[model samples]
Target: MTSSTPQTLYRKIWDQHVVTTRDDGTALLWVDRHYAHEGSFHAFDQLAASGRKVRRPDLTVGVADHYVPTRDRAKGSAEPEIREMIRLLDANTAGSGIRLFGLDDPDQGIVHVVGPEQGLTQPGLLIVCGDSHTSTHGAFGCLAFGIGASEVAHVLATQTLWQKPAKTLRITVDGSLGPGVTAKDLILAIIAEVGADGAAGHVIEYAGSAITELSMEARMTVCNMSIEAGGRAGMIAPDETTIGWLKGRPAVPQGQAWDAAVAQWQTLKTDAGAEFDREVRIDGASIAPTVTWGVSPEHAEPVTGTVPDPAQAGDPGRAAAWEAALDYMGLAAGQALSDIRIDRVFIGSCTNARIEDLRSAARVLDGRTTVIPTMIVPGSSAVKRQAEDEGLDRVFTASGAEWLESGCSMCAATNGDMVPPGERCASTTNRNFRGRQGPGSRTHLMSPAMAAAAAVTGHITDVRRLGDVR
Candidate 1:
């Protein structure tokens, strides 16, 4: 008697996209959608060199997020290279009849943010972008991973990519989140527990009662950091939450088509007893708001916890690593996490710039003032418009925060946003890698509320203690 193979959502999506299988463990899988940005110039160059036109311009989209100035995009970029990149995107996509969301497009925003909003990111699609945060699209029940420049060109020319299927890992977070706990906190806590490479060589699909209960935007925040956990991609099966969110979106099918599309999306879950390469469990309610004190996403701890002590490092290697991190961060061992001073604060990034995230930060800052400089950048122009409509911009700016336009501002400082040398910043963006924000910058990754707390106190803080700050 033969046992039946269990079906998983990951495998199901993979099977749906397989165009051909080769003997060398390679498969040509059709790409359902591709998002590109300024960094894709090299890929376009490669496509031109191959004398090939984009195979499916309809399936491809472009955004000017990476190098567009978030502050003054309207007057055009002062930097010639930046201006050239934006112009090239316009020319290339127009020449190919592909839609481009340029600097002034009403739909223009961070690529990841815009995709879901535009109905381009959908369940069962195989998506790729030149940016690592493409995993962000996975929240919508799709397979999305960042590809290299060459792979970008290949996908452009053929509308498919040669790939190997990755092992599957399922992480289940149960129970309700604790007070002040957020999707950002939950993901940070997970990375810290599993270490930076814990999910390496696999695709992670998050599930469980808590995950299912989360809002679509919150789920996106969780999946957005899948790459930081070293996973090839992250996914969450689409359900009612996803269906409801996509139902009225302009890009989604409507009328009878909408009904049929959602009917298919409803089936996109891992079947019971479906085996995975690995599994992990977390108790969501036990999670405290977390913050990264060291250099990587794994280097995070509860905001209420103490700074890591290198002396407690288990081995010489680990100790040296801890010591080095502390020194580079201008920190000493055993310091309280909430006591660390910060010179700046940033509350924007694909990871946490959604409307809900901005509201969370605003809630913490109600009737308060920032003790230091702070900047609040929305993930897209639409998000900015929504914030303004809700009076969130006034609340933020009234409290000493700069309300800037969207476009990955200060998330990586790619377009003129920078942290002064030797200064520390409490940032809601993912990654605390050395100089990720700017030269000699020390970035502590936290939730938007936590970042807002730091802005008010001028130090790393626990938002739960805002009562005391008040």
Candidate 2:
């Protein structure tokens, strides 16, 4: 049934997984991989009540993230409910014969981080999880996205999901990224150009020279925040960079099988002249080190720019929203971005907690100590080990930063890791929504280097402005 018509990478993957389609345009997609975390308890409960066992235990994995503590795991969580959540994940996964990466497992980490690290995420696979950051897996050219609790339950029972086709969007970033500009800054700038809901009812496919030049980690960082833009998911065409990174991963094919897999992956690119529902072009050189000034990621501005004035907004509805966000963020319109002081800093999350991110922050903190409180949480146990091996941990520790265990710490503030009320934080995690880190907490989202710079100066300082680290 293969057609000669030009097809996008997303369309190719989606078509491959269609189990069936209804008369109303809804299709049942076969789930290739499903990862469950602590928050999936409700799904498991639903499955239990339905009297159905997991159809494919081998295709399911349980990760103890979200509610898992980043510190003192041996003693478990102080809160009884949090402890029970972890325990329930263990019980459910064990009961269903599904592999569980518990808190004590050496491979334990955030589900999105662990998936690719373990090679469970692969090109052309249809992946899903209860967590919104499931889009992170799409970096490998997969059609991955988040699913709700009921969807999770259905997948657990049938290994299939009913979904409507989303419009395809190709966001091409041409040219090379300038010095100090990163994938985080690029994504922030894109979100700002198109408002928060600009990509609604669409799936984004990142392309062009700039995107191809980015490392697999940078691609993951970009795809990870697609949910923030109200997108169904985000994807990048598989290439040499992706194959090289997946070469020796434990869960990937091996020997001759690996060669065959790479051969098939090579054809995963979008055909020339493929028609997209929409298209956007961005000049990478024009992007600057970006940061969020207000409550939304769309409130991003360059480090050299000033806070936006609500009254200047052309649309009245947008102006009102800007006013409310400015009030909640406690910022004055037209104020210099660098003048904003931060009470603390966080450098970890599915978005920017990989070894490269750690290295970037370490470079900025080489000889400089942080002026304010700072915490560093790795994405996974493997990343933590790699950082320690490279002495990046020492670099962070030397800079007066607290180096903690690996998990989704401080990003979601679900496991007792939270910023004190009314405090401002420079964080590498995605999203700057009000109370995201904690109640009454203000979050300023930026790249790891930017956050490290803010930590050293106690203000939102640009990494490029720091004369020299050596």
Question: How high is the CA lDDT of each candidate model?
Answer: 0.90, 0.93
Error of 2 at 30 (Å): 0.7
Best by TM-score: 2
Candidate 1's error at 90, in angstroms? 1.6
What is the TM-score of each predicted model, taking all chains together? Answer: 0.97, 0.99
Q: Point out where model 2 deviates above 4 Å.
A: 468-470
lDDT of 1: 0.90
Clash statistics: count for each candidate: 0, 0
Q: State the lDDT of candidate 2 residue by residue for 1-470, as single tens digits.
A: 36989999988888899999999989999999999999999999999998988999999999887988877878889999999989999999999999999999998998989999999999989999998889999899999999899999999999999999999988999998888889999999989987789898999999989999999999999999888888899999999899999989999999998888888889898999899999999999999999999998899999999999999989999899899998998999999999998999999999999999999999999999999999999999999999999999999999999998888989999998999888999999998999999999999999999999999999999899996632
**What is candidate 1's lDDT per residue for 174-268, written digit by digit as tens?**
99887788999999999998888999889999999989989999999999999999999999999888988887887888899888888888888
Model 2 Cα displacement at 440 (Å)? 0.4
